[model samples]
Target: MSDINISKLDAASADFDRKLQKLLAWNEADDRHIQQTVLDIIADVRTKGDKAVIDYTNRFDQRHISAAGELELPGEILKSAWESLPAEQAQALQIAAKRIRAYAERQKIESWQYTEVDGTLLGQKITPLDRAGLYVPGGKAAYPSSVLMNAVPAKVAGVGELIMVVPAPKGETNQLVLAAAYLAGVDRAFAVGGAQAIAALAYGTETIPAVAKIVGPGNIYVATAKKFVFGRVGIDMIAGPSEILIICDGGTNADWIAMDLFSQAEHDENAQAILISQDESFLKAVEQSIHKLLPQMERARIISASLSARGALIKVNNLNEAVDIANIIAPEHLELSVEDPEILGKNIRHAGAIFMGRYTAEVIGDYCAGPNHVLPTSGTARFSSPLGVYDFQKRSSLINCSQTGAETLGKTASLLARGESLTAHARSAEYRLKA
Candidate 1:
């Protein structure tokens, strides 16, 4: 009772719920405009093919390009860009790429068709896509990491061809990004981006070949395009703003937690970084840490806005209460930086990924760790999963019924089809069972 009394539990439950409904949430209306644009762009690209892509590139990119073939990013640019990366940046990219590739390779699954207990051979054949589109976002932030996170998995999953479409805004693609793409062993790289690039990938353009699936993070525009084109082509997930949730108690230091929160907040103004603490004193300390740390950051304005607007330093009744809040949030990244993080980590059911202990940082997982950084956001973690080698893979059910097995399965199928009032389905099953 004494501990709970000190927390911020005043008559603000309704207000908090309203804020929660607004923040830590995604807006459907915002995507409608983007969807319309993507649909029009997809239609234009489909009708005009390469010409439409080139025209959109020139119009949107402000480039002086005339033909779609001209929009095909030159190989020499990647070659020179790869050669020009500073030794340190180049080495860092290689190290991260290696780690991502190794992790993704491990996630690759093989097909398995096995005999069931009922004498029925039922299994799925895991196969890779014929081609996949990888969207690497370059606006607001340069995510060379996005390149490896999205493409390496496809490579490991044995996707036949991996094409990259990066929205190089202002007619620019960073050298480090190109280097990352090169090192990741991308099959094709194009300069066109945004909803337009998604259109080219979803529908074939003469210059840009179509892909069976698209993966990676992007702006809302890119996410909307992915959502609109899902039926025509597969997408990894509609990633929203970056999100991180940290749970702490009395034993943890506030400064480290505050810094971790800032890392995600700095990514964008809409990004969410939350700290759930059992101790009111601990929460205050973290607030101070945030104040102390904000002065030194280069992106302090963006971080401050995100924290004051959407970031939460929640004071819960106990560790269990903290865990409950975290489960509801289903944050993209979850960290347990308590005295016994491993013990507390077991309570978490819905998170894209979990980082345990004070020594483990979210940035570690973002860079060199053996897990994926591409994760579900905006509570999608409740049902979805992180981007993995499986995203680029396809599955085919293997069905080969022996004479006896066919008789049994055919009878069951006929019964189900008849129950569902599908005479054609029942007749097909009857034919299989016929003498």
Candidate 2:
């Protein structure tokens, strides 16, 4: 929002990264203190079951549900929600489901068993987790996109059952999200949300069965709870605030660039929006555009705070440096607003999903980018990947061997087993060889 010079802006950008690095230097989610904490929650939920879940829901949600059965949303409500939605809205959800389902089907891995050397056979049989729980945020922000993104993949992966949970913030859930859930083929859905829903999903209640995995986006408490319950049941990732990075050339329109940055900034106060450019004049124009465009937004105060705090306009040494920095940051979303988006795209290695050209804004990725908007954030992109059909599927190794093959395989196995000093393993292999 300020008309700062390039030098000051760069210094500010450097400071932001330095502070961010310090804040996240240690991944405390894995620290022993926190590690045992999640385990305790999982244990309490697992053993006490419905009572513990109700206690947690009351304690965390600050709402009084009469009992455990009250947590699960009724099928009629979801069905009514589906029927009540505008025909166009319903159709749109169906269309999104179609695209996601088709894509997810293509991503699905079939059960394969193949013969290998020595006549031994080994392959992988891909199957879906029996049950999955999806958490959709509620209140002013209800993401229908999340339903399609999280459920369709699991559906395509052949998951036997899909359950969704969303906070009925203000004592009510959004019909749009519920409609989307129906379209996505969810087996069950509930009004219970927040950490309590996650706890219930990880550890079943009397009414709601525990799920094999949990996916979708939520607030900090939900995210922290997901981190806690991870080992008990699978979770997509430890998600953080949303972010978007753009590398722009001098040729693009400055107004478009500013609004694009605002799109991500408006997501949350903590969300980040950054622009790196080789041309200094273009960067200044973009900054000016951001200032001019600030007043036009209904959420001007929020956007300005985000821009001033987390957003930046950086002057890079060259396009190469921009790409290198982009990879290092490993942003959740990266856009090349440059002349040749494809050229810059090749240099990128660490990003959840990339958008080429100024026209492909990060907002598109949020709604219709055809990629899971549920991406790893807070630099987790370095190791984690975006949510996909693979997240919902489990792969099991297949091994079959003829008697001759077993004898030959066992001989090699015995030698390696002895090297590791596993006596039982060595004896087993030797016995197989002799047999």
Best by lDDT: 1
Looking at candidate 2, the ten consecutive residues that score lowest on lDDT are: 3-12
- Candidate 1 weakest lDDT stretch, 10 residues: 1-10
Task: Kindly provide the TM-score of model 1 when superposed on the true structure, using C-alpha atoms.
Answer: 0.92
Best-performing candidate as measured by TM-score: 1
lDDT of 1 by residue, 1-435 (tens): 011111233112657656555556666466566667777888888898887777777787777777666666677777778889999998888889888888787888888888865577888899899999988877557888878788788888888998988766667778878888888888888987878889889988777888999887777677777888898999888877889999888677778888999899888777888888878788888888888888888988888777766787776768887888789899999999888987888889999999999888899988878688989998999999998988888889888787778788889999999999999998887887858
lDDT of each structure? Answer: 0.81, 0.79
Give the lDDT of residue 351 in candidate 1. Answer: 98
Each model's TM-score, in the order given?
A: 0.92, 0.90
lDDT (Cα) of model 1: 0.81
